[model samples]
Target: MNKTNSTKKTSKVGIVGGGVAGSTIALRLAEIGVEVVLFEEGASLVNGPPICHLHAGGNLYREISDQQCVDLLKQSIDTLRVFPHTANIRPTVIAVPKRDKGEPDALLSRLELLRNTYHSLIESDANNKVLGEPSDYFKLYDQDTLIELASRDFPSTPSSLDDWMIPVAKNLNLDEFKYPLVLVQEYGLSVFRIAATASLALSQMSHCKVLTTAKVNHLEQCESTSQWNVHYQQFDSTLGDWVTGYEHVDYLINACGYKTGTLDNLAKLPRERMVEFKAAYVTHWEHSQGTWPEVIFHGERGTPNGMAQLTPYPDGYFQLHGMTEDITLFPKGLVSSTAANAQPELSAPFIKKLTQHWQQDEVDLRSARAINHMAQFIPEFSSATIGGKPLFGAQQIPGTDPSLRAVDISFDGINYARTEIVKASSALSAADAVVDKLQKLQLITNDQHTSLELSFPITRSLTLEQVENFAEQLAEQRHYPSALARRVAF
Candidate 1:
């Protein structure tokens, strides 16, 4: 390893992880004239990745309980509105296609429960009038109408609340899959675009210093100065060697994703550290048309493992993702270390069960039985396996009369809803908190042209060759072009 030095500063920032959270903090702080040193273990911003509006993740609808967490999320959403790439974020459709009538009812109840998380969107809900499934989608369509609607082709946008929500015709895949489809309008994000746009926006600001090749060693605060010393590793691509260094900053923000949390002797932080493990698969197919929305399908054949997300791309590719609470990914009693293959006592079986869950093993189906068998076998992940929120009758009938009851509501999560909105909101809020800390320390003055305008120039266009080179530079240098780079290109 080699040694390097950055100009010592008391107020500099060293952010680890190049994902959405890290980038958002870097960009926002840099815009405010804070010298930020973003160190990513990855090559680029989206290089790890995600946006969309509304609550994109399942847990976001759940209670955070922590006031600071809620504040972070609120600030995150507000900050997202200003980014140019957010304009590309469109509304998403979460469809609950239930094989049984009771399933739809349970789905609505779950949504109603989610509504209880927020106060503004209250309603009478008489006769299930305003269930708040985006213009009361489930309420508007009855069993007969939904059954009839499902008999035809996927319907067009209906004459409903066209502002925030749009209702979809239940006739999607009519003959092949004849389930009552109850869809609500939510927002979906293309985080890659957000990352790309963020990188480009970062290029416009000269104050921020981003380093992609660095790896953080640890965090330590000096007792005397209260200054933070951020130790990291860097590779000299020229010499093909690694170097170690440190950045002394007055304040520290840990955007290091899941790896930062620690309890006793564990690979990552504790469960309450707000960490999760989400998996997704990408598939491509022929499509005769575009304009399809990202969909969350529950109580359907395709989603045998919890819930599945089908996010379609205009480029003809769709991604399938599975979301769950991550209390299991990190096992307690396991010491955190840099060694790759070395693991704790339960790591082997835990990873086995976890991977099987993601693969949806045909033999075991990655179900409760499989999980139980693993729990009995290993017992290490026993407590870890039990952290997800209950969907309340999500899997089966409540009591007797399985035919009369509906399955509980289900949703897919990508490790605590790592969408552009969630990431932006949470990250920006954290940035604001850091700024508050800096203000307490008097590191920055009141104002210095902080109002930065984010624009995607319409006049800028690059050739195919330039596009390829630009793309490479983006991944290598971790810089993206302005969001409008593709909007009005000639």
Candidate 2:
């Protein structure tokens, strides 16, 4: 273990975990001149194993709006352009049309309409820059045209919109119509890589320090200075276990990702208040000659078992991720164990089913090749799980679904809660330390009806429920309001 000292008076940010959330926040904070220290249990970016094999081309979707998606696409393009190796991460999308067994002509007409609509959307200024010279990569092949070229051909599969659109597709506007290759090219190889690079880029600009192999054991509040004292252990192959202590500004941020449960220990909240969800991945093959499909199937077939993603990665690799359900799949030590035993069984049958449907549509499967297989779990409904298990659904508030839970906390005496909120920090002495900052800053004010309102333009796509759950997680961690304060008018 090695020790370094910094007596700088700037706000010190200690970020736990070096994954996407942690690294991104650390880099952002560092860019703003804050003194930041990033701690990762694993090796830092250079020495760490590849985060994941999956490529996240759905960058256009996620939780944002169409306009926001466009903006994010542009941002992602600009960010990737700076890195030489990122050329492979450019954008590519392939559209596949599905037809009911008896409605071939109807499917063809729908395909044409979809193609036209997609072309219009892609041609729009919102997409022009990202699509580049449209003629270069954007070309359409009629179903008949594609079928004639294939050695084996069949009709398109039965397709429906209700199930496909309601959840994931609706979120991205892909549910509105069926089309091929909405926007496909190459992008980053994995969500983790994109996140890691973003973090590294941010770190380089901000002068923030990152310490790998450092796991925080606990945190303590200093009554004298009202600062946070952190106790952590650093591991090294050359050196034995080295325990160390450090102090940071009163504010702390928890971007721990799935390990968010760790925050419960450092704060006043019970572990049951958070919920964990799992997302499993399996790898398989398709022929390389066939172009990658643009439409991400969202329904049971698209997602598989109500909780999976069958996405195509670059270089003929496809990642078939299982459903997002309870975190039980991620029980202790399972992540590593699963990754080590990569097998076709984990995702083959699911991919086979998807491809079978594609084959009915006369799509070629031999074009894809499998390079690897893996699985992962994401902690969702974080405000509603305890000890890695979910709380009873009966305890859920009427309007708030337990599946989407949230937390809210307010000081007892304050007319308006104003405070700097920090999570997983040892700095909180009283509620005011977290809540008073917002109140004093006029971020939150007393109102008879609602507790808070936004005074500035805050752009986000999270639903009210998701926001509430996020806020609850912040509160559970003893952080002030997890989100910006909004004044509820009387």
Candidate 3:
């Protein structure tokens, strides 16, 4: 366990939910000499949808505005600085399919802009050079170069940019894509590793108490002391019933992802928000060359020709996401809150898929569709089979705009802040906003504490082997293949 700081504790904070946002906030607060009580309904933390891509430059989504892309780039760098072990350090391949109306050259301006932004970040702080040299932020490959690389065999280990592109050059059907295919520095993030890291870190924090299998039942503001009384029911298997308890906290932070409205309704705060249900399939392919860069065949989203993504994992396991309505998206998958209720109501089928086991037939059918979708680009992937159950969940977008990727903390009262993060990378920004709010309210004092400035006590102390073992155990506990926890090194 990480030792408590010599600084005196100031105030108590109550946080609901144990997703990335909650976990990040709890650790930051506890590390800065604040008492935190984190409540998680699930047995573990960060057990939501599978997060594979870092979106270092938001290159995958061309529809979002340039500002959102830059914001994502900054947040992604901060995330890597905090959880360096969770990164799968490989570039991503993006190609425009022949059938798609988009052109490859149109992306050049944005790539150049991203490269400049990265250079500026590095100039400010040399440590910000996490994604590698700004000069190598992205590289373009002509058809002739790809053809030449295709003739060479896959190397045992990849050392250069060309080395990483070998599998893509050999496997991808060049005729189907436009020339000048681009390779960006965007990498992959292992959700299992993040869960393990958060669990270990929270356990060691001296002022942080993580209560798993505990659900918040009620919240009441104390008129006398101005503290909030948090009532919760923790399941006790021995008694076969839920045991009720309460905690008093000077401030409250709602970090629930999709269920943020539950706490909002309890506080009688009205807000406009939308929730989206999405999933990505996992497949195993016996590829002679084990490692491959994340491949993207960009097409319009929700249409028949939607984007198809193939994310590589260890042990020949790959995760796939087809953005078509029939694949990762479903009918009525995206819903918004009605004026009567702040909580958006997902269909019963989606709720069942989220809370219970997915039907095996549906999984097989969807997995097959994803396979066929990728096989169109890489024929060898046609033989891949389902590796595990789908990684599915409902994510909350702060506003009604589904295209909005950037979000932060919103204050409801003097002591209450609600975080609505669209992507996992935005968690740190949300936490920083809460920290700033705490200081403004005089709930905590310490102007010098920053995520970048202060060292992460738990993650810094853990070894790679310990993280791998714990991540594998988390994967098994969550009914996923253990290979998902292993790092992909080539």
Candidate 4:
């Protein structure tokens, strides 16, 4: 139960949907002294999966391409330290499975070519003096280094059928892999990390209220007062049941992900086009097993929306994502030209397609396909049981209860953003953009009374590698934050 800030009680903003966008906005607004009330329809910030690459929970990569904030990803990654609920940075390995025709993937080929180029750059003293290590953020390992690193860091059962990719695939349980893995030093976007951190921040931030299990139903603006009346419902304890209530908010931000259309969506903002897809989360599959990087089986270009991705949590368990989005085929996944109108079997096929290479007979062939694909990387998956059945779905963002009355806050005073609702990273990026827009609109203002900003700047030429090495030295000597990063696995 958070109380509004008495000191900064002048401006109160209401945000609907406590997903990535809403949570980030709430934190930013609270920092700037705007009273925030974040309403989330879901009980938790990182809702249960059936997750996707639009899986927003973790990465704070600065090269978000859109330049929403050149440093937002860096700032977002920093939250792993500022907040207690998240995991620190870990070296992410991207293994591209071998392609057909006895050749490496064109993308991987280019990546290897780039690595050679970077090696040349590092070796060139003139270039180092000129470019200053543009490859500082990554640790691009060659075939032998990747194999040795994987074998040392994540030791699992070596595969039997290893030839060319043998060096990189030596210790990894995956029978499928590419040589010279791409090791990203600061790559990862974890949903659980964002959920825990954001929820904790919302709980602790002054003048902020995070209302879970609350659904917005109606929105009406008071033209005279310039405030919006927000009507929402929630299960109230004192009332002994569900109750409807209203709050008068100075600014209303619709950060609702997929449910934006249920209300009168904001004009001029990009519209998020969501499609139904199927995916799975397996907990028991690598129960108390070895660590693995975020493994993505590369699909055709720009087809992650319909591809397979395996992501690991801080706990070492993994979520395997696949999509059954072939709309022309009936029952969804079975896109056979002849069986177009076949019976819809649901998630079994999506999971199967995800785990196609590995073989499992326990669940029907339709379902086992997905599980088997996962078993290649996670051998325990072959023996492990499913935690929960996979389901066909779309964005995991809070959905409007069809039974409840609907609201359209984007009428007059309220504002909304309609960018594609992918993962939590995009949400935070979107929030930054929204905050920028609000700053221009005079809806957001910095606090005059807040504590003075940190003005210290260090004068040093220590490279990023040096700083990281120093951190590692400190981590070894004083092992505290290391638990959040290195010792995270049980």
Candidate 5:
């Protein structure tokens, strides 16, 4: 493949989805002079006024480290700085520690130790530059010190999570300093809408064709030429019908999240090689007053089980989400309506469990709202069997009550599965790299605060090269994935 000709040869890059991931990549590629074409299956709707929505879990930019803080300030100033018209507000997080009786004193002592250790580490040569000159901004305080400050103002009992958070807060000097999270202001109107609209604008600006309501159906691969023909269905507004057609492209980028069915057919990958899981996002209350929290709390109670995060936006609305867990909540197959709605009562219990664990006051349940209530399934491959036995079958195992569905594929057959799986797994490896980089920065702790461990079974069909490359990329990048320029051959 000639690099220069690859850039010139009608270089029509077909993007499957028009979400954030797709838009970001498209914009970057366009800036670099890549001929791009984007296809979206849904109609473009004007996204509502820019409401402050929280970023995904494990997003490292949320912290107040010197570099992150500076980066955030710069980003806000350059991109999200304008207020009133644009909404931008930063709220402070108040961490309360909850420990068993008589454990507060010990926990407080430990917190002091951790605080000092953190301070030392921050002051050390490697981190000193990132932490900046330690002034009152990055002060350290023992439990008594913080409690005294809190007693003078907002007094509250401490929880274990709180104990962990207080040191972090004090170390970062959350109090006294007027950090970015302190001010509540709107920088722009319809920023989210602007973001989505920007995608369309970018496509036009880049001279890339965007076809909405067009669903990709298949891919025709020529063995001789090693090229691909992408088939898609486009709805004809005039005819009030659908028309099918085909387009040629050198590579297929799957930006479709969780919807691997189309890619599965196009790539002709095996079914057992990929797994899918469901995740639910429920908004319990809307912020009517007060600013959002600066330090969003995302922590577990002891084990890696219950995960909850609280994101307070400038809109005075706080979004709290339950952690992702693998429970037999829904039936086996693509989670159906019956399975999702079967446990309406579970919502309250879920809220109660998180609130109790966090020791926060009962939020207004009446204010509860839910979206994407659908179950999320994640695909995994099984690589090996016990005693060198070949495992290639689907089994229905009956547990105490509900029966679970399990599929085992031989290690030899994964490449034959959907190429999307390979791409997705590789993408995950890249994401893991980012995670690892942040972890080294002490911004995130994996397998502790976040779930980075492979919980899904590996299919035996994945090649050693695929698995090793993915693992190597993941380990090298932590949890962050690599860029297209670095990972793919042009």
Candidate 6:
């Protein structure tokens, strides 16, 4: 490690992990002239677990509380304002399957609550109306209306809700689900776009140093200076060996996603958290030529018949997630940190999938199961074949509860904060919480341009065309179809 004392005084914040949590904080802090150093073990940022849906209203997860859904709505709006280019601008369809105990009417109260909350947010700030008009935040269509829509032709570009619903009505087995299919303004979020945008923006920022493909080996706090020394190693291509280095900063943030507990263990801060390993499989439906909204068939999680999600991508690609033990979730996927070690250790098989390559047979098996899960509702979807490798990774949920969705930053001390974001949309709120902490510590001023303005200097420097190009490039680089970087309808 380089023990250079020259740059110690200027280093303000050091972030470990280049996931959305760490990337958002680095971008937000750097926007206000704060010096930041972000470390990512991966080659790129925001390459963690797949973040397909924006979760604008948390309608997908029926187990979560109404308050959590409301919080998700607000946080998702904040995310949209900052990264407008990432929004897919397509609505989501939430349906209760006949096999499930949930009634469609039971969801009406929560949808109404979300709509009212959305209206209130828009009333407070007109800019919060990114998910379309507040009045159209959600729409309900009875079985009869859907049956009528099935007879209509699917448009190439959907101009109205009925046009978007036509594909769902034609493809989906309406008899298998209850009446009143709810279409919400919840949009899709492109993880590739976020990765491209954050990587580009951070590269251009003078005050922020983005260290990709660098692994943090150790962390030590200086007793006298009250600063953190983040020790990391990067591979030197010329030397064909790893080079070690360290950065000293006044504040530290452990945004390591599932591995956050590793730093807490190193700091000897025994914190309670859970890590879950989840995967979403990609499939290509050649027969489906029309644009379809994101479809959700509600079922009890962890059961044989679990919630099946079919998220559409451009060019016949769709991501499927079956919330059963043998599919997207595993037998011991959710693990809690022990008292001795804050880092909850996943089994070798799960770790292998995360760090190393997943076995071809396992991918094929799980993906087939996911396809069948979706085929339960859309019988024609049984023919869909595997499109690409599964988007898989582990995520850190702050508490022991696996269902917790809404979370922000939690501070261990005045200078140390840990990000525990369950959903990607919560990343901006976690970043704002870090900013608030900095303000409280008198490190960053109150008037330091903290607002999430659409015209931020760094984001404004790039156009939507540039974002599209970079996002497609990232998707291709990651071995995924470039079409996955695009919106379904728009």
lDDT string for model 3 (399-427, tens) is 77888887767888557889888888888
For model 2 the TM-score comes to 0.46
Error of 5 at 290 (Å): 4.0
Which 10-residue window of candidate 6 scores lowest in summed lDDT? Answer: 1-10
lDDT of 1 by residue, 1-490 (tens): 0001212233576566666666776776665556777777655664432233334223222223334233432342344344433323344454443342224344455544444432232343122212234334223244455455434543343233322122233324333223444444334444445556556666666666777777777666566775667788888798899988888765555554434332111222222212222233333333313244455544322223334454544434444443332211122312323333211223444344332333334212323332332233223312222111111100111122212111111111111111122243444444555555555557654333222232112101212334433434553343222221222111
Off by over 4 Å in 2: 1-9, 45-128, 131-192, 195-206, 223-226, 269-287, 290-295, 301-310, 313-315, 322-490
**Which number leads on TM-score?**
3
- Worst 10-residue lDDT window, candidate 2: 385-394
Scored by lDDT, model 2 comes in at: 0.33
Give candidate 6 misplaced runs (Cα > 4 Å). Answer: 1-11, 448-450
Tens-place lDDT digits, model 4, residues 54-128: 211122221123222223333333333233233333344455555412223333433344334435644752322
Ranked by lDDT, the better of candidates 3 and 5 is 3
- TM-scores, all candidates, are 0.58, 0.46, 0.97, 0.61, 0.45, 0.96
lDDT per model, in order? Answer: 0.40, 0.33, 0.87, 0.44, 0.32, 0.87
Question: Candidate 6, 300: how far from true, in Å?
Answer: 0.8
Model 3, residue 3: what's the lDDT?
A: 28
Error of model 3, residue 65, in angstroms? 1.1
Instruction: State each candidate's clash count.
Output: 18, 60, 0, 16, 71, 0
lDDT of 5 by residue, 1-490 (tens): 1223223434445666654334433443443335566666756411111123211111222222333223232233222211111222222242322311222122233323433443464555232222122221222334455544433322132222233234233333333222222111112122233233334346345445677787888877777654568789999999999999877754445444334334644566323222222222223233122222333222242223322334432222223333333321112322211222211122334333322321222222211211121101000101101111010111111111111211111111121211121111122232233233333533333333211211111121233334334433432332212210011100
Q: Put the candidates in TM-score order, highest first.
A: 3, 6, 4, 1, 2, 5
